[model samples]
Target: MSRKHQWRGMMGDVAEKCGTTVAIALMEKLGGAHFVVPKTYTNRGPMAKLGRELAEPFIAEYAGQVVDIPSKLATKRPPPESRFQEVEALIDKNYTAAQVAAELGISQAYVFKIRKAAGAPKISSKVDKRQKSLFD
Candidate 1:
């Protein structure tokens, strides 16, 4: 005895019924044009050097944003010894300092200090994992 084999084609009719176009589908995929938005910064590369040169050092009366706000309140204090581990976990999870601060119920600035103290790795401002508003 012998058997015949056959293959069915794509259900383009179903796709059509779903009302999705080829261009629309591809644009919504990862690395697609629909979702990703490129960042726009004021200065970059060589301009950053020039910017630094023109930047002024913090002054006593510069009117800082968090004046008198204790940096210690940035994140939860588990213990002095566990600071590194805690900070490491947050970084590994790619959470923003603000996210860590919020999770640990503290301030974003303090979470930044923990990161500095641990020295886990470099984090990019543009690619902060937690996707938080900088002003927050």
Candidate 2:
């Protein structure tokens, strides 16, 4: 059988024994690694990283077995243009460049670039000398 078939079979077994949620968590966490499920769940074991609740079912079914999880589970990124549009929309809503960058997981510089490209006014950080302080 092909490696893909083997991977599917292993994942199916995990899903059947541990439920789909555990199977997916295993795939996401242990993908591309030959991970051995311990016979007994331990806080110090490799499965400990998954936390007890998520690790127990997998250990019950796959104890002492080395699972070869595929590496194709990486999340796909949205297109660059779509991301740019998202930045643009956030800027239009008057979100600060830092806020836009944090919300979109992009750099502040990239947010500034998008703001400039959209012809949005730059947000100033300097305090006005003549402005009265709220605490005064």
- In candidate 1, position 47 carries an lDDT of 18
Q: For model 2, how does the per-residue alpha-carbon lDDT over 1-136 read when each residue is reduced to its tens digit? A: 1123233446766767677777677767776678777899888856876789999988888888877765444223232344667876765676777898899887797667655665655657434445699998
Off by over 4 Å in 2: 1-7, 72-136
Query: What's the residue-level lDDT of 82 in candidate 1?
Result: 50
Candidate 1 lDDT over residue span 25-103, tens digit each: 3223221121111122125422132232221221111213221211122122343335657755876787767777888
Each prediction's RMSD to truth: 24.4, 12.8
Summing lDDT over every window of 10 consecutive residues in candidate 2, give the lowest-scoring window: 71-80
Compared with the true structure, all predictions reach lDDT values of 0.38, 0.68
The residue-level lDDT of candidate 1 at 66 comes to 22
Q: Residue 72 error for model 1, in Å?
A: 10
